[model samples]
Target chain A: AQRVTQPEKLLSVFKGAPVELKCNYSYSGSPELFWYVQYSRQRLQLLLRHISRESIKGFTADLNKGETSFHLKKPFAQEEDSAMYYCALSGSLGGGSNYKLTFGKGTLLTVNP
Target chain B: GAGVSQTPSNKVTEKGKYVELRCDPISGHTALYWYRQSLGQGPEFLIYFQGTGAADDSGLPNDRFFAVRPEGSVSTLKIQRTERGDSAVYLCASSLGRSYNEQFFGPGTRLTVL
Candidate 1:
């Protein structure tokens, strides 16, 4: 079974401080990892995907195959960065059930100003 | 272009009652998905549709939960004999064709059983 683990349920950090949200996944084969964010009064949206290897809104996640981790990081946290972050894992492309994503219990990041 | 949209933003029903939630995907999107999210938890996949056919429904909890996309654009999820545990936010998302594309999510319908 493929599963995504988000250890932190709630994370509080002051504005302008560096932030890191931990995520660990378990899958037998290659996996596709992604981070989805849900801001207050808004629907869930894609924040970043590991395959892209690009930062969005200053947030970046690096997939470590050896460690089976895809931790999301930011140089400096801002008020707008506060949201519920979810770590999702999907099977490799071309697999029968890869399109559906398995999301972890989300981590709520509260940026204090 | 418009994003995904769900009808009946909020629904309140008594236990054992039936309910139906609607979703209208973005124009030209052939893949649609349904998810259920409880308080403080991430969304859970329920079903996926490709064009007018149900490509996958392994995530559905039971037979009481069923969905249909006859016209390939609008879909409806019907829950029979609803239980208290069924209360959650039903989210609908759509992508190009169920590949590796980002899914566009709707506002979600909040279902409450009392």
Candidate 2:
């Protein structure tokens, strides 16, 4: 079994302030980690994935195997970034392509101007 | 092209009643998935379909939950004897292929079991 944990249910930050969303996972084998974001009244969409090793919308998450964490971070936060963020993990099951995502409870971020 | 689409954006059903939620995937997507999101939680996987066959359905909570994708395009999730605990937002997603591809999501159907 796999699990993703996001300790904070809500986070608030002033505009231009730095922000970080913590995410930890428990999986036996290698896992693919992702950060998903859902803006107000919008469908959930992928923000970034660990494998890509790239930044999206000023947000970046590094997968640390030693700590089993993939925390999303941004140097400067904007009001547009206020939304619900989810940390998800996908691992192969039984040697197949069953990439089922196990997600955390999610963190709702509020970036105030 | 349009992303995934789910029908009956909202559904209200009485206890013990059966309800069916619909999902229409992208035109050429071969992999479709269903997930359930509770009030404050992220979406939880329920089932996955590859073509017309279910590649995985392990995330389904119980026997009362079932889903089918005919012709590998549109999918339907059926819930029998709905309970209050079953109230949540049902999300549908699709990927070009199954292996770790980006899954496009729908707006989701808010199911409320009263």
Candidate 3:
């Protein structure tokens, strides 16, 4: 079984403040972690993936295997960053080779201007 | 260069009725996926199709849910004896292949069970 947990349901930060959205996961094998974002009236889109190790839209997330966590972080928050963010996990399980994302409940980030 | 698209942006139906949602993936994409998002929850995988075959249907909640991607380019999700709990946003995504490719998502169809 695989699961992703996002502790905060809602997070608020003023513009230019640093923001961090916590995510924890439970999976037996090596897992791939990803962050997805959905803006107001917009479709869900990929924010960043751990494997890439590259920041997207001024946000970056590092996968910590020892801690079993992948927290999304941004140095300076902008009002436009307000949206729903989800942490997802994918990995091979039970020998059946298929990649399906298991997502967290989601964290709604409100960047106050 | 068009992205994934889903038909009937919104649908309202009564309990015990049947309904279908459609998805049109990007041209040349070989992998299509279906997901459901309940209120205040993130999207949950429902099914995955590789080409014309279903690579995974394990995420489906029950037998009432069924999906098909006959031509490998478009797909449809069907629900029978729909319940109020089935009301949610049905999301469709597509990727060039099933591996670690970035999946492009559609706007999603909002299903409301009355």
lDDT (CA) per prediction: 0.94, 0.94, 0.93
- Give the Å error, residue B10, model 3: 0.4
Query: How many Å off is the CA of A105 in candidate 3?
Result: 0.9
Model 3 over residues A2-105: C-alpha lDDT tens digits?
Answer: 88999999999999999999999999887889999999999999999998999899999999999999999999999999999999998865564546888999
- Return the DockQ of model 3: 0.71
Kindly report which residue pairs in candidate 2 clash with one another. none
Q: Write the per-residue lDDT of candidate 3 for residues B2-92, one digit (tens) a residue.
A: 8999998999999999999999999999999999999989899999999999988998999999999998899999999999999999999
Tens-digit lDDT string for candidate 2 (A1-113): 79999999999999999999999999988799999999999999999999999999999999999999999999999999999999999986557454788999999999999
Evaluate residue B6 in candidate 3 and report its C-alpha lDDT on the 0 to 100 scale: 100
Task: Give the per-prediction TM-score of chain B.
Answer: 0.98, 0.98, 0.98
TM-score of 2: 0.97
Candidate 2 error regions (>4 Å): A93-98
Candidate 1 docks at the CAPRI level of: medium
Task: Give the runs in model 1 whose Cα sits over 4 Å from its true position.
Answer: A93-97
Ranking by lDDT: 2, 1, 3
For model 3, what is the alpha-carbon lDDT of residue A4?
Answer: 97
Backbone clashes, candidate 1: 0
Runs of candidate 3 with Cα error greater than 4 angstroms are A94-98
